[model samples]
Target: MDLSRRTLLTGTAVAAAGPALARDDAPPAVLVSTWDFGAPANAAGHAVRLAGGSALDMVEAGARVAEADETNASVGLGGFPDREGHVTLDAVIMNGRGDMGAVCALEDIVHAVSVARRVMEATPHVILVGEGARAFALEQGFDTTPLLTPESEAAWRRWLETSNYAPRANSENTDWPGGASDHDTIGILGIDAQGRMAGACTTSGMAFKMRGRVGDSPIPGAGLSVDDEVGAATGTGVGEDILRVSGAHAVVEAMRAGLDPGAACRRVIERLARLRGDKIADHQVALLALDRQGRAGGFALRPGFTYAVTDAAGQTRLVRAESLFS
Candidate 1:
């Protein structure tokens, strides 16, 4: 009955327990997310976890903060519209128990993450898309809201004049007040008071993208994946590059194979470069991972990707992502 010495295992994740359990849990739980804007969600999730909430609930609540922010152009209510002027959202939520749900290319629903959770808990299906997703959200009692605000509309109009689809180098994540956009998603991973892990991925997809285009955000393994015993992982930036490798799942698999969080994130980015060097040379992709023990690591294709972390003491701050090019 030596639980401390024996290895703890998650569905496909395994970890040495003794040393990890001995590490500081001062702020006993940990929350990590993809970008600076995630600071708010990290704080919100931290509060819930500190109060003995489930990590799954914290992750969902945290993600909802961004989903409701009209100023954040990459996710939720006021996100930049697609090329055709429609603001479609995609989101996914997964818990330590392996239960998961997602919504893709869903229009008019601001709380897309909540809708995704309903998909995971209320229905037998794992995914719902387009009108089906909208219909389901409505059925779930979520009211319709305008996703594309006047500010976003004007930006789409301005973009239409030149009609350029190529994303600029190092696009702005909060350029809404400023048309110009990774700059991509708010992917979060965390461990709760009871040592359970959960993760969530939410985004409005690429700015001014093709109307029906969907990215890694709504795809479980690509955008987010969690194994309560081992850890959880999430990805941001260019969803296309992230999708090609199922980025988040790759990180969790690496952890299962004995790589620490930092090493796992590095290996994934290196593999991505090896597989799509030419296509990803100019694009950005970033990953953030947390082992069940509360250790975390973040890696990216470029230097601008920053992530936020909060410990059990209610303290939170952003960590700059390590880049392969650097």
Candidate 2:
């Protein structure tokens, strides 16, 4: 389970799966995102790319799919609420040109990613928070509606009995409709035919968390980072840990230092493990990266992390990412 052994195992798995795409033959357009739910999101984003949309357009379009999925309890509409029974969303969007925007602890706005985009385009500020974010969204024509559904409220009530607040690894992949999800964040990264890059991250944050709790989903360097000259990276899982190391930005810097997308992601996971030691086993921090050449890869602190990839051919598939622990 050490880093070197894990690297060897991951390398063997990669070899068995297939060789990495050659840079010269890399797809002109590619989309990659976190989790199984990301499959449909990738398809949506890919459609934007096929329709001649910019990377910015592709990422925003993709993130909206998950934000509107009623069955997903870790995102928009039915997301699990905080201990106070309020569902506050966090989201961020960034483009290769360094333009970025974010909203944290935002309430009543389902398309938080789009609001983040508006923050980037309409205001000189890069972030908006709480009531201010909601006000901005409303002024921009976004409708205000309750995001917590009956199922989520029931689950929150059940959670009050034990009041256990331990963060769970990969809980978002569980039976979400039954309100069994926690701490799931959807992060999407894309490259257009023009080779432009963009990334987005959104989530309702950890289930039954403190009322004002905001995770890495809305933090630029922690949840998402994009660079036209290098690549883009995004993370999902326990946000606090990711924030400590600026995980997403670290992955992009590693890629800029000449590592492949997978290697870059793995290197960041290794750093996170070293930083947290044995405690890392109790939480998951998965990272997905896409290089400027359209190559994509993902890595995680533990098993059970999967990402969706959509290539130029319009084929979308889920990839189970390699992990530091067996």
Candidate 3:
């Protein structure tokens, strides 16, 4: 791999022989997810794969781990609420066949990804929002529960003191002064042994954001895109900019145009850099991709971005993504 186009963390390799390894040597099944928390998520997803689950099952199983984690303030039940203390969630699920479903600005739903799947499987609509989404979830047998925990409520109260709503670059990956890290979304992609691809993305949106704010996570092609013949991609970070460029779809298209997964992700980040220029320094964005051959790569606008990968053999590793401004 060219150093200019792809950079790997010191002492970390995307695969034992790196991403450029021959296709025949690629793992029979592969799972990749955004952020350090994704390591365990991948493990959870891998268990599904080991049980003969499809790519769709792997992605969904993986996402549920983070969504149920109360310590993870960026996703699911314990996520930080909006300015009004409303904990709205967003999620999307996409299959390689181009079918997708999403939910945005949903309240009191812990597993928004499952609701997204229900939307895809049960409804003619591609999306459901707010009250409609909650109703649909209830009709689908999903229970409504209070998502706000004491820890998150305390964090929201602390933010109420200053009421400063400035977006911080990599805030999801770092510790705040008086509170736990206000994390971001979890995006998981998988290619099963049969080579089918699928992806899922779920988030609580930006911490202390305006009520009803929806980010890229719930939008297909922005947060996630999967093409069985081409590849799959998903993103995290400042979703506004990611959505503006259809970040995940762009990476998959680049892979179709012949770029490796890493280079494809880098291409999109470079475009974001040019579009935002110096302003890009104020926020963070990152993308992770998996080709049909089970190869994977990731890139970010700033450092400290990490992703987790698990192969067919059940080996898992956390990789610090290469960044443009590192």
Candidate 4:
């Protein structure tokens, strides 16, 4: 559906440095995510928020929804395997107070977002990677298991038919080519009972990626970022393009500088196009943002980019994001 700015921003959120549209004492609230496929995650996160959980709690819980999904080759266990047939994961979490944690090049663990939270609440470090991330997951009580699923295996074999290591922008992992970006991440932002914000970003990196390749999913300020005083942002599409300018952080900074949620997102998209020059034509990069006051906006490099929103009234919808190329 075409969501007007009013419809996109419809919801009550926590008290933030910016003026909120709703009352300060608003009880429960809405959540926003990077992809149209994020409704399930938004539902899960909203359920947790309804039960009085922290926004951080809901954000992690919500991301777990995507982690467990096998049909979506872009994320979690069912994701497309690396060129070596390994399914490595990357994830990050940013809490209300600006504390952050991440896991990169993680293997076998289905719930990478939870492991990221452990790094935030359990360790003094900001990131854990490779075998170290697996160790942290093991110590945190996650059982080791093979992440490669039957569906992922079948897809990998299909890719091997060509045996072409040369990658296309959106040709890998998905059923067909030319829709979404290759490096898509499930990114979510939520505000709970308390007037605070938190967010999560998780992915299986790029499909058929090189062994040990880690995308922006586990990188703060690239895949996701939250500032209670200003707002929050998440990204999908080309991780490399997102990382160059720390896309999410840039959006938050724009919001802080007086751009509303939508305007900030559009400005970031413009910047991405300018910085990347002609490279972005073959790929896509999207940014989604929500201000402390509950205003939201999204923009993308290509024609097809959509974000999900679940409002206080429990209505969830997929809205086509504004796109420069469209």
Q: Pick the candidate with the highest TM-score.
A: 3
* TM-score, model 2 to reference: 0.90
**What's the CA RMSD for each of the models?**
7.3, 4.1, 3.3, 5.7
The candidates, ranked best first by lDDT, are 3, 2, 1, 4
Candidate 2, which ten residues in sequence have the lowest lDDT sum?
11-20
lDDT of 2 by residue, 107-216 (tens): 99999999999999999999999999999999999998889899889889999999998986875555531122333789999988888889999998988899999888
RMSD over all Cα atoms, model 1: 7.3
Model number with the top lDDT = 3
Give every collision pair in model 1. 27-312, 27-313, 28-312, 172-181
Where model 1 places Cα greater than 4 Å from the true spot, the runs are 1-29, 173-182
lDDT of 4: 0.79
Candidate 3 deviant stretches above 4 angstroms:
1-6, 9-29, 173-182
lDDT of 1 at 244: 92
- Which scores higher on lDDT, 2 or 4? 2
lDDT score for candidate 1 against the true structure? 0.80
Over 4 Å off in model 2, which ranges? Answer: 1-29, 172-183
Clashes of each: 4, 0, 0, 0
